[model samples]
Target chain A: MVVEVRLFASFREGRFKEKELELPEGSSLGDLLAQLEIAQKDAKITIVNGSAVSAEHKLSDHDVIAIFPPIAGG
Target chain B: MAGYAGTFLRINLSTGQIDKESLDLELAAKFIGGRGLASYFLTQEVDPDVEPLDPANKLIVATGPLTGSRAPTGGRYMVVTKSPLSGTIASSNSGGFWGAELKRAGYDFIIIEGKSDKPCYIHINDDTVEIRDAGKYWGKLVGETTDLLLEDTGDPKARVLTIGPAGEKLSLLAAIMNDKYRAAGRSGVGAVMGSKNLKAIVARGTGKLKPAREDECKSVVKNALKKIRENDVTSKGLPTYGTSVLVNVINESGIYPTNNFQESYFPTADKTSGETLAEKYLVRNVACFACPIACGRYSKVGEVEGEGPEYETIWSYGASCGVDDLEAIIKANNWCNEYGLDTISAGATIACAMELCQKGLVDPDEIDGPALEFGSGEAIVEWTRKMGESEGFGAKLALGSARLAEQYGAPELSMSVKKLELPAYDVRGIQGHGLQSATSNRGGCHVRGYLIAPEIIGLPEKLDPLSLEGKAVWVKIFQDLTAVIDSLGLCLFTSFALGADDYRDMFNAIAGQDLTTESLLQAGDRIWNLERMFNLNAGVGPEQDKLPRRLLAEPISSGPCKGHVHRLPELLPEYYKERGWDEKGLPTEEKLAQLEIA
Candidate 1:
């Protein structure tokens, strides 16, 4: 399965803005995060398919994954 | 020798007497100035049982060592008093020229006491302080009052802090407005000032602040500012969009708190978002004195052109009330600024009444012929004006959400803590925020321990917003850190870019003192406990550290966190344990002894 990932803020500054990620069917969110070239320690990932999702959660096909550097605005 | 004015001006409004007293270094060493110092004064001087609006109440306007310095975002002050709304210690911090001017005027703080026999204003120029008659400006709006004071003082650079009709009427949600728009806008501190018959305070200063080590201080500030500029949020996001960026993000997260929190999110969030405001209404960017980031937005929506609403105010009056009109939000923001009202409390109270009207809990006749329904932008604006002047239906709404709901016999519907209304965040989705709001010293406030840094924004570290584990320790640390920053007159946004080490360096450079992160954090803890002690002595205790039934019992009906409720029970015990407090929420004597407090 393939999923489109979008990055924002500092994450967008690093390299790719959006990418098509090829992953196995029924891959967990952690597996997808590990596949990206981006450092997991640097990026704060949230799956924004209507709601914020955790990394350990499962991802479905076409799930809009939005990743960004840690936000600190009040 | 540096970082402080070394003195404070004491004014007895009743006697029209002004005196200058040397700053107490021992107190400064313990409290570290600003809100901390104000808390010390409030606890030491004001009796716990005295009514907030009574003559016995003291209003302490304080500035910190970092205020007016070159430190990043250090231009802020705190107005501390017993809140008429909550009857607890209320310290509302504001960013503007007033705090910087106060420091330049050769004072670290101004302690005001005793009710005046008539309207008066305090004029402070350098070392000279006087109580002047304010009869001409008594009934004016905050803007008009500030303009008149500036004109009267004949100094265009003079900074003025004043109250409006809302304050004059002793509204529980009245605010002290400065720089025409910036406000210490919560907990009814303005009502306390009005009760003392203080109309305005105009300050003019010609002195310069000298840090103990000018070269080192300048270097520290430069480095901190550079780091702040490098940060994405402080440098780009906030400067470009102000705080309105949170609207879309929180809305997307399904924690926008729409319609008095009955709904988790607003469908029309885009219409009331920061991006829309910046694209549509933004005219220019403004900054407080000595501030580099310029996060303040000046906007023009129709005829209104001034300071636009931040994310909280936009959410409070826009999505929370079910009003999605951007122009209406701008107009309401202007009105609140002019009227010197806390927009969050004002909007929350109105939303509560509107909900009551919808459920037939409140009669339409009582609302003065307007159907107080959700999304009524017209009614919101109209009633805000009324509330500002304490007229018609506005009179009732000025009492604040908890009081308004209690009056209608549906206090459970009010989303508030200690009578002060909640801000933009919905606790059902943000459980740490729920605990923070419930345990905030003032009331339902986000600033006290903004756990959103870790939970929502993922700053420093990522934590699950839905999880209850380890939040107690984080909340305690954040609370202590916030207390230090707030007391030091530094903007909390600086924490996004800089840590306690940077703050300690700045402190050492400015104050000529050797300080460590641990020591500074201890100061924050001391201030926090002192505030809690004040509230505890003021009759607010474990019973008050509770959410409304709506938040505690009713799960969010729809959206991402649908059927989810705040897990306060799961978290409160841990929070208590971390704070060294008893199950009843009382700070134990052992903890006090450890902190060296008698």
Candidate 2:
């Protein structure tokens, strides 16, 4: 299965802005973060298919994932 | 009186009389300071029905109790007056060194009343005040006016706050530029200043801010500093990328309005995102007076360099106009600053005009400059300059979106609430932020109550953006708390790390007050109701508490948030109930009595 992942702000430093990753069918969001070498604590906002979700949430093929550090402004 | 300079200047521009008066401590305590106190003065002195550009409408520049104090990010001031744009009471806030300098000059605020027969500028040097001739500087761009004013004063250290040609011509979208780039940039406050024939204000102060409880102030300030340093949003995110960091965040969330909100997503948002700006154009990060966050961005695009292209500015000129040319957006941002125009309103207005042209309501032959076409970076940059100068058809664009759309007989095409243009966020997908924008005293504003913080950013805690539960309560609390922060002379960014109790402690220590957290919020609630009352008296009533027709009736055409429309009607009643107002959204007498408004 393949998932599209996007990164923003400082989280993109050294890591790619966006990429597609191959993972097992039963992979969780946490599994994708680990594969990307991102600590669970640093991923303050995690979204799957545009809905915010916890790391333990299940992911499937073609799911769009985005992760960001704690960021805000008006 | 320790936190306050305890004095203010009342200048009658009509008669050239400058009277020095002591601040009323009792009233100051009731209203807090800055926006709250300034609104109190405006409501009392100016008739709500008066034309906003009339000399009868006074421009009150006010600093808060914590302004120039040891509190982190305390350098903020408000330009309060009747708004020509929305016809509601306008209080536009700006962060920069000028507010702190004004406080240091032994004055808490300046009230300029009446109209001057000749162009003039106010010069304040500690105790000395003069209304100097400003004929030579009239009609100049903001940067030139700032430099010319500094030369005339012979004090380069003096801070300059002036209006550019947009204000001089009374463009409804004009902004008051201070420190050359920082702006009290909404509600057409600059037009009010221009209508009074006042061009600029220069201040260079040598006095010091005296905190009432010096020992308590030190400890409280230290605690604030520590929390700010520890917070992720304040200490890292903002300082690292500035507000433009949100471009990707909002775009990914699918609520980023594009092409005047004809769509809710921009595919190439990353091209204009903060990361790209830092990589390509950023010169350095700039900080306001005593600011630790330093979220201000100074960027260069070829030979033109200036502060910002902030999150809203980028969205307005980048995504909102359907233009992904980052360099062109930077140039347009510079044009806005130089011409003293609100970048959000300017870009959003152009976006509105593009839609009108697309629908054939606006004739292409009439444009005469750039084609009113989406994705044209040339249109965005050139239209912005023309709008500021009010040149040719740009004069109609200068009237802002609401007027422009109505003139073309497609009033619904204008993406605005009241007469003010909405910002970057597409409220159709964010319910709470939508409700806040609908009911904002100043129309279509985000900063009044940025529910986007919890809804999208997950600051403090995250709320499901699609959910409708507890949103009214959230909106009320956020709006109230924001009023308190604005009144205290502090930046809203501080609220991400500091809570209501932190603000309470700082106020008590600095102003020598015994305010509990509840009473402190109650004061904010009072300010909120007071503004509502002023708006009501101005004939901008509950009927105006609505989002644009497109937003309320149309769903976002595509994106992750597809088929979602703002649930404003469902939430407005609950909001009114939370605000202790009647069903018509008017404040009840009992609520006013509880808040102790005279």
Candidate 3:
């Protein structure tokens, strides 16, 4: 199955903005982070299929994942 | 007030009388300083019922103990007055060297009251304070005015605060530009200044601020620098991307507040994100006095160069209007600074007009000279120019989003609270921020509390952005702490890594007090209630403490936050309970007594 990944802010630096990767049938969000070379601490929040979930949460086929660093502005 | 400059300057513009008074130690101890002290002074000096731009209104330029000291990110000050836009108490803070210079010029604060019959500017060179003729500089833009003032004062190192055509025209979105680009930008403080016929404040101070325990304060400052360096967001992310770093994070969180908040998502958000700006337009990163985190951007877009398009500034002009052009946003941002208008209010007002035009509630021709439609960068720039001049179509736009939306008979479409325009964050994704907006004394402001950090960024602790639980308690905690930080004349960003205890220690070392973190928080509460009371006396009630109807009724139709509305009703009750307020959300007698507000 293929899952789409999106990177924002500093995470996008020296990396791709959007990438699609093929993965195993039941890969957790952590596996995708490891695959993308994104450290767990560096990823503040992981949004999978539009809902924020923990790293242990399983990623389904064709899931859209977004990783962001701790960022806020006003 | 021993740790402070130990004096405040009072200028009665009506009589052209300037008096320097010793800082009241009792008042300083009670209100702390800066925002808190300014609020107390505003309520005492100016009646709430008076017109905001009237001669009777008072503007308090306030500093804090940390100001001008060797404290990290301590070069800050706030202007407090009744808002011309919101008709409520407003406290707008700014950073840069001007605030620190004011402190060093032998003043903890400056009170400007009454009105001047002729254009004037205040010059302070150490103990020398002069209200000089500003007739030549009156009509100039902020940049030129600053340059002329610095030249005329014969102090190249002087820090000048000035307003441009927007403020001179009494436009509701006017901001007071300090140190060229930094501003006490919101709540129309510049309009108040313009009404007084004051154009600039130039300060050139040679005196140094002496902390009570110099060694202890230095130690605290070093520790603060260490904490800031260790924090990824402050040290790396902010310095690298400027404030625009949040562009992608907020958009990804599904709460970017695009297109006058009609949608929570903007497909072209990436086109104007921080990553894109840094790559294409960034000239360099800059910092204010004594600041380690240089989040300020010195950028250019095809020779139109200036300081920012800060996170909210860009978001206000970019996704909020669906204008994906980075150069357009950069131009719009620069225009706002040069002309002295609050970008958030100006852009948000433009977005509101575009929506009104789109809805057929108002015609495009009524806007005068442009399509006034979303996604048009040219329209954004043109209308911004008009708003600055307060001529033709810009006159109505200058009234701000609330009045403009209401003028079209669609008051509910304003996307504001208490008549102040909301910032870039759509409250549908963060209930705590919504609560903050609803209860903000100065209206739909983000800085009063900035509950977004915990909800979206998770500074001290993370909370589910969607959850309505414990938000009231958390909001109160953040709000109180923010008050303390603002009073300290420190950047709110430092709160991301520093704790209340850290602030307490630094303040104690400087102020010659041993107050605990708990007492510091208690002072914040007193300040909060005092501001609320001022608004209450002005006839603002529980009815005013609410999100817009769209926020309460319309769930986000798309994006990650698809099925969410503000849900403020569910949260306000618990928040009131936590605040020790009645069901009406007014501070109770017991609570006020506990905080010694009276």
Clashing pairs in 1: none
Query: What's each prediction's clash count?
Result: 0, 0, 0
TM-score of chain B of each: 0.99, 0.99, 0.99
Model 1 alpha-carbon miss at residue B428, Å: 1.6
User: Candidate 1: which stretches are off by over 4 Å?
Assistant: A1-45, A50-58, A61-72
Q: Each model's C-alpha lDDT?
A: 0.86, 0.93, 0.88
Candidate 1 lands at a TM-score of: 0.94
Among all windows of ten consecutive residues in candidate 1 chain B, which has the lowest summed lDDT?
A: B363-372
Locate the minimum summed-lDDT window of 10 residues in model 2 chain B. Answer: B359-368
* lDDT (10s digit) by residue, model 2, range B420-506: 899989988889999999999999899999999999988668998888999999999999999999999999999989999999999
Model 3 CAPRI rating: medium
Order the candidates by DockQ, highest first — what do you get?
Answer: 2, 3, 1
Q: What's the C-alpha lDDT at position A21 in model 1? A: 81
Better of 1 and 2 by DockQ: 2
Clashing pairs in 2: none
Q: Per-residue alpha-carbon lDDT of model 3 for B356-426, expressed as tens digits? A: 99899986557676788899999888889889988898999988988888889999888888998999898
